[model samples]
Target: MGGEGENMTEDAKDPVTYEFRDGAAWITLADAEHGNALNEVGAAALWRAIQRARADRAPVVVLSAEGRFFSVGGDLASFAAADDVSAYIDDLADALHRIVSELMRLDAVVISVVRGTAAGAGFPLAAAADLVLAARSARFTLGYTKVGLTVDGGTSLLSATLGLHHALHLALLNPVLSAEEAHRAGLVAQVHDDDELDAAVDRVVAQLVTGSHAAQVTVKRLLRGAATPAPETALRREALAIREAAARPDGQEGVRAFLEKRTPVFPGDR
Candidate 1:
């Protein structure tokens, strides 16, 4: 991350930017204008970026974002605009699941740097990493329920990371957590002052890059092995549930209400 990055993706406007800098692979969420919303295209771009990092066998892989938000999760406007929202979301979830799976299976130390907001898919992506570093101003949330979608992007893994009731809190209430709050909940490994984040991450990355790569990968695999539901199974279930939910009346109402900036009168409200 410290070096002047050489472009890996041909177009600078891709959803993600991948580069080998220093001794690590840096993959940044580059679609900042729309809060780095994940859609099929972005998810595919992210998967390719992760694959590049995996292929490089980088000892340290850094996942970060540009602008204010890490990622706001799926693109609701895009879904609402699609002729078949269910199919669109299904494809999106499939793509995102692959990214999450690849990131977890990568034989490197993955670190997510959270500067602002990391909600919905962002939450699980960061949580899946070996370590998560956050700026003091960082925030986290899981607002899928607020939009009447079940959830996807490996969010089911939150239970293993945050415990059952805490995961439920995120899924049901959609409460936003400050970086300090997330740290207390064990999602964040380290928190730094807003401007000090890079330096802090740099130190950790330097340490990781010089450390034993096999030992690091072994540790990650061991811990992941202990996680319940097998992330793959959970991801598939989430994708199915989300696709079904997206086709439901509640989900449609939620998306319409969101784009219209109004309260959703879901089917249950009748």
Candidate 2:
């Protein structure tokens, strides 16, 4: 888990954009049309962006997305199209977990600015950060149950941080929670009205950059150590569970139903 292999070669067409300036590294998800859905390619690009921030020793890293969604999580269309859906989903899960692991180990203050929906794997993607700043328009949900897949991207570990009741509710009912709801549930650090979210994030960035970097980093490590286990094992469990689920009849019908824009008739229904 030290390193998640070399990142994909940087390309102009990658779905993530990384830029370092003013002591902060900005990593923006750029695949708006697809809602920045996590796939192997997008995951690798995101990994590269995280690695770049690490290389630069940025004091603060801001993770944001250009799309209406922070990310829609796994791309169901791709899942349905995969000739080997289980293998494909396993690979995607691994790729995303790699990113989550890196974020957990990163020295900088990792902040995710969520403006819209953060569903499925997206929930953990935002929650993995050291801080989550969200807009009033933001929403959070697991969404995995809807598609008959288990949670991945460190959700299994991260959800522990969110407490059992909240996690159970999300994993079971798949209800969408607003940013204020997320804040109330201790899932987000701050929530501003949509128009003011960027300004709020900028202010937080300034404070993080100007504060005692060493102290903050040490606190990050200390709190994380006390809060949860290493992300690798829990994440691996999620990845494996997802793969097995994806190979089952419920997973098959669920993914197909999602892609077909219809209600999923899960195994229990039959």
Candidate 3:
């Protein structure tokens, strides 16, 4: 673990708090007073935090929020207040899209810890993570239509992951899924009791930190590649990545530890 403090920003009112510790970067949505709704400043600050995590070479990145609801999605009040709603949304979407792109391409394993309701863009943001862990009380819904908006933050990716039929049901109806239902629907990977959520996340982070960073990163890349439409290209990339991983010190150490029947201490772990 590392020191705990709010991320420094010129604007003290920024709604995101970022911290890097051990081999993980923790990004918390700090605007709980407003249900963590993202306004222009919050969106930009979130992107900056993601960029910082990428640059820091963290092996794992945890995305969580400070309030009961993970996020209510885009700040509707901000949008309403904007003189030109169209332009406001356009810029907000651009910033959020950049953050989504970074998360998709990042080598670090991304995890979303959801405790309460994740709606609209928030739902897609959680879906974008490599893995999602939700408290038993967590709820999720694609709430765009309810607000007279379409979707953003890579909702299409969620549709692809969930398959068209289920995706349509979620998008068109905006029905909330409980944590168990989300897991059944393939949206969340694990569900923990509300009281156990923090420990569960910590356990996962500890496990990831002990593994070979190079191999884990390569695996993430390979999985992303496999998810794309280009199978042949994805296979080729996977082959190259595996070979590259095998040449790295952590990979070599992993193999050696397995052969010796000893616990592996990856470079990042040290």
Top TM-score: which candidate number?
Answer: 1
Clashing pairs in 3: none
Instruction: Output the worst ten-in-a-row residue range by lDDT, candidate 1.
Output: 1-10
User: lDDT by residue for model 3 over 108-211, one digit each (tens)?
Assistant: 99999999999877988887788999999899987665443466667766655788888888877989999999999888999999999999999999999899
Candidate order by decreasing lDDT: 1, 2, 3
Q: For this target, which candidate reaches the highest lDDT against the unseen true structure?
A: 1
How high is the CA lDDT of each candidate model? 0.88, 0.87, 0.76
Residue 162 of model 3: what lDDT? Answer: 83
Error of 2 at 226 (Å): 0.8
Residue 258 displacement in candidate 1 (angstroms): 0.6
- Listed in order, each prediction's TM-score against the native is 0.96, 0.93, 0.80
Q: Candidate 3 — worst ten consecutive residues by lDDT sum? A: 231-240
Clashing pairs for model 2 are none
In order, how many clashes per candidate? Answer: 0, 0, 0
Q: What TM value does model 1 have?
A: 0.96
* lDDT of candidate 2 over 1-270, digit per residue (tens): 112233233565679988777678888998999999988879988998898888888889899999799999999888888999999999999999889988988999999999899989999999999999999999998989888888888877756677887788888899999998889888899999899988899899999999999999999999888887567888899989999999998999999898889999888536
